[model samples]
Target: MAHTVTDRKKLLNRVKRIKGQSIALENTLENEPDCMAVLQQVAAIKGAVNGLMKEVLEGHLREHLGAEDLSKDQRLEEVEQVISILKSYLK
Candidate 1:
């Protein structure tokens, strides 16, 4: 979406941070860190990913479903797409 272009940099930064956390988790695993340390790393990665997903989902809702220029059919299609994705993501 064109609106996403404006957010591309911010999104990329989040992705980069997630990548760093993943690398740290990998290193922690390799070094035989304590169970709690590994668990904390895993939780940090999950939280970062969830935050990214939340941001992207909010953007999609605002840009696709809340746009005023879209037709009724278009809005319905977007809603269905969102529902399908949510189903898959939640599962």
Candidate 2:
């Protein structure tokens, strides 16, 4: 599937932000920052990672699972995968 340049750029931007967040987290640990502040940063990083995953998953569903020629079994498998992903994230 062909992704627009804009979409690619957006994903790259998100990844870069996540990388920066990771570096900050490392620095915070090295500097012995406040525990609560570090925890909050970690939570924000997790949320950003999850948001990025959701965007990719939604794109996959729209491009592959939504294909008109997909068989019932294929669609069901995709749905199951998505459900499993959600369950794993919840845990």
Candidate 3:
């Protein structure tokens, strides 16, 4: 699927933010920060990553899957694919 330059920029920004969070986490560990503080940072990074995934998934569903006309089996396949992705992410 084609994406506009703006869309690419947005994704790049999200990636940069995630990268920063990861570096912060590393620094926290190296500095021997409080355990709770490190855990909180880890949780925040996980939440951010999940949010990014959700955005990408929603865009794919709307712009690609939703644009297609398919048989019941095909639609079911798409749903299954999405479910599998969700399961993997949750794991």
Candidate 4:
């Protein structure tokens, strides 16, 4: 995950936006907003989080799985780890 250090700023910005969106959602709830507005805010937050997950997952795949220096066992371990996380995420 150290590879993420290279894109830490960009990742932090995304996280900041997500936090803002969450606050907006909370405000909408507090104000007794329309259902459609609440749903839209929820969707935006989900999409933002999914985008972040995709970026990190891609980096992990390219840097860890695609490395030529990994042994067979190491490669299998990486694949298994990815699979386990993906399963949890998908659920």
Candidate 5:
């Protein structure tokens, strides 16, 4: 969220592009008869989503958990939260 204040426009643009890709995937699923075409669209959408996730997660780490000026206690708490998130996400 800290990075979002500065990077809102860029982040929103990425989300919009991902949304467009998802819509295209839906359309292809409904109209395209070819199995390969649907699979390609699905792959593209998945990649876009993964890219967005990577960007946001890195920004969060840099902005919050990785901030050098924070007290050790605060940093440890934030690190635990990030670790919890990763644990669930990877599961």
Candidate 6:
């Protein structure tokens, strides 16, 4: 929750931008229906989503993986979990 509070505006902004891009893509599809334009919009939306993923992942790393009081084994477990998530996400 601390990370969410600290990055509230940032996260909101990213979501808002993604929303805007989605709407724009929808409008373009309805109005122009150009393949290249649609491709560009899709790419932009994917990039925005990836960026948001990165920010959240970093926050998780800072808040959980970087915790100072966790035992070494616990930290390693958390790291492995994070890695598993990343692998699944990238696929």
> Which candidate number would show the highest TM-score if scored against the true structure?
4
Model 6, 25-77: lDDT tens digits are 99998895999999999999999999999999999899988889999999999
Clashing residue pair totals per candidate (backbone < 3 A):
0, 0, 0, 0, 0, 0
Best by lDDT: 4
Can you write out model 5's per-residue Cα lDDT over 1-91, one digit (the tens) per residue? Answer: 8788788888899899888988887887778458988888788878887787788888999888778899999998998988898898778
Give me the displacement of residue 43 in model 6, in angstroms: 1.1
Q: Per-residue lDDT tens digits of candidate 4, residues 1-91?
A: 7769998999999999999999999999999799999999999999999999999999999999999999999999999999999999999
TM-scores of the models, in the order given: 0.94, 0.81, 0.82, 0.97, 0.84, 0.86
> What do the candidate models score in CA lDDT, each in turn?
0.92, 0.86, 0.83, 0.96, 0.84, 0.94
Between candidates 5 and 6, name the one with more favorable lDDT: 6
Writing each residue's lDDT as its tens digit, candidate 3 over 8-36 gives 88878888889999999999999969999
TM-score for candidate 3, please give it: 0.82
Give every collision pair in model 6.
none
- What are the RMSDs of all candidates, in order? 0.9, 2.2, 2.1, 0.7, 1.6, 1.5
Candidate 2: list runs displaced more than 4 Å.
1-6
The sequence of per-residue lDDT tens digits that candidate 2 reaches over residues 18-88 is 99999989999999699997998899899889989888877878887888998999999989988898899
Write the number of the candidate with greater lDDT, choosing between 2 and 6: 6
Query: How should the candidates be ordered by TM-score, best one leading?
Result: 4, 1, 6, 5, 3, 2
Off by over 4 Å in 1: none
Model 2 C-alpha lDDT versus the unseen true structure: 0.86
Residue 13's lDDT within candidate 2 is 89
